[model samples]
Target: MKKRSFADLFFLLFVVYIVLPVVATMLYAFAGKWNKTILPEGWTLKWLATLFQDTAFIQAFGRSVLLSGGAVIIALLAIVPAIFVIVLYFPKYEKWIQAAVVMVYSFPGVILAVGLIRVYSQFGVPMIVVVLGAYVIGILPYIYQGTRNSLRNVDARQLLDAAQLLGASKMQAFRKVLLPTVYPGLFAGALLSFSVLFGEFVLINLVVGSRFETVQIYLMKKLSTSGHIASAVVFIYIVLMGILTFIIAKLTKQAKGATNV
Candidate 1:
């Protein structure tokens, strides 16, 4: 048998750290009645059925999807073009822009939520507007960093020259050449932000008010009212997120392959 290296050991530990909570949650979710006892009494699908039957859970799930989709679309539309412009035309300011984006990322979610609430209350903006704003601010840093890295890796000069050589317009070059290169990174950023946003509660709670319950908010409610139901909701949430992550991972992988070819 071969001996494991320190890196391998660390990697194994990291995997365990990631999976432990998920594994425990899955077990509890299946257990019909897991209490303060050492182990669950038995396993059943009752929790899953109860979870699906809840109308509020279904609505919250839809809202999360709508909010996340809107945020990602808006972020990409604004961020991608802006990053491209900065990298292509004003390379000198790349460092400064990157620094600013990093600083934006450092803004705590709760604090940002609080600020948004004050602004919204004064302006008479609806709760949905505030929720969308929070989503955009929260995910901007991820999108920015991903795009910046993608731009760094791609050769802007080559793209420009190719376009000119082929008699393609600037817009064509940007659309065809530049976009293809950076899409994988951008997709990755969007996916990461989506994963985080799906489960996000702090900002949404503060900005939209507790009356508007998202999936996470619903889970919080269940923890007190019905822990078994909460566990079930969490299990479903994990499955949903895992599926999303898997799709994004596949998309990113395909994007990388296309870029390579």
Candidate 2:
């Protein structure tokens, strides 16, 4: 009983430490006057209203959605198949492939940006190519690791044997059986990649410059000029992430339960 109580207290403390700042900042978002005060003077929705009305913010938000969404789709389409191939067929080259994927994360963003600029400048790549490249390279590790982890639950030998026994072709077996089993992980990876790319700023800022303005860039600009509006944007981002996390948790849970049942 005493140990349980101590563990509960510790967990509560950890949660409080993590959540208090978020709570405070979210409250500040609704503050009519947050300056020169211990507490907000009053609460109002005007900050949120203004935040939603800003044309630059709106455009940046849309761009973030587009960039992150497209990046995740492209990442999944590319990575999932590659992982499946590595797992099912090219097991001999798994280490090399994984090392290559992981190396993408190891490259410093600034260095990568410089190299990309040099090559793209010579090749005359468009802004869209640069944006997509940033998104893919930045989030590659997250998707790769997540997909690898998700593949653990799937029994590869069993899948291959079942396919052979049923006279099903390798492609059909993979498409029908292996793909379904690992889809939860793929979905998780996609969501994670999307989340990472959503808040990503460094690569995009360096590569695309003013040609692109994502949510994070817009928020940074606001922060430098208007702290309150910046706080509001941060609050919105927190809320958005929370919603996405909740959805991912629910979906993952449902998937696991279905598989178990």
Top candidate by TM-score: 2
On residues 91-145, what C-alpha lDDT tens digit does candidate 1 reach at each position? Answer: 8987977787787778887888777778788878887877887677668778887
Summarize candidate 2's per-residue lDDT along 31-93 as a digit string, tens digits: 887778888999988878899999999999999999899988888888678877787677788
CA lDDT of each prediction against the hidden true structure: 0.80, 0.80
lDDT of 2: 0.80
TM-score of each candidate? Answer: 0.86, 0.86
lDDT of 1: 0.80
Q: Candidate 2, clashing residue pairs?
A: none
Alpha-carbon runs more than 4 Å astray in model 2 = 1-20, 258-261
RMSD of 1: 3.1
What local lDDT does model 2 show for residue 134? 71
* Error at 84, model 2, angstroms: 0.3
